[model samples]
Target: MPSGGESMLESDNGTLGWLNFFHKGIGYFAYTMHRISGIVILLYLYLHFFVLSNLLRGGVAFNDLITSFTYGPYDIFIVMDILLSLVIFYHGANGVRLMLNEAGYGLKHHKLMFFILESGAMILMLLFLYYAWQVLLSGGGV
Candidate 1:
């Protein structure tokens, strides 16, 4: 629409440039996910403090929380744990990819590099999912 051969990322109105950034490449998407997953992991760390603080209240309180987590219908937490594994994997793989890029590697083959890193993350996520499901089915559930 620009008639001068600008990419789709450059909107005719110019105000939507941010919206088009995701289409730039896998690297950008991976970058965004990295930031998001880091935030999520940070938030989870805070939640750990909250949960573990129960120990100070009393051992029984802490034990109850642990019991609730490992028993009953709390399967959702395990599912979340599996999802968190995925986020962790993606965050790590993307971090490595970014490091290699900063070290002057994979600049020319960025897309391929992105695919390889993300594929490895997916595989690792699936492996974790399998192990987590086994735990869930083992009646040790958690």
Candidate 2:
């Protein structure tokens, strides 16, 4: 018989755990997005804490940290903001779906409802991007 560690490794040898989970169905897609978005939000929380901690040094230090993202050459900040917004939407929407199912509502049409939720999420994302672009054009940042 295989050792415990060997068996565990063997079980996953042909497939990546969560990536394989993606192929299952809409339910799995919702599950994976929820997990991934939760992780991203958690990491962003850690980053927010670190950024705020800079304020402990002085207002100047904090402003400097903030400037690095808001000023030139770091479109990454806007990109991350967009992505974070999208993740937050997906996570919250999926949570609502879970809550609905738990309450014995929409269990049969959960997939259709998920698509509807995702469409709304996409609209919100586009609205965010439009405003961010306007801000950029207004010389709010370089």
Per lDDT, the best of the predicted structures is: 2
lDDT of 2 at 74: 63
**Superposed model 2: Cα runs more than 4 Å off:** 1-19, 139-142
TM-score of each: 0.72, 0.76
Q: lDDT of all predictions, in order shown?
A: 0.67, 0.69
Write the residue-wise lDDT of candidate 2 on 18-40 in tens digits.
44544467766676567678999
| Candidate 1 C-alpha lDDT tens digits along 22-133 | 5556544555466678899999889889988889989887777776676645646766776778888887887777777767777677678778988998998898788866
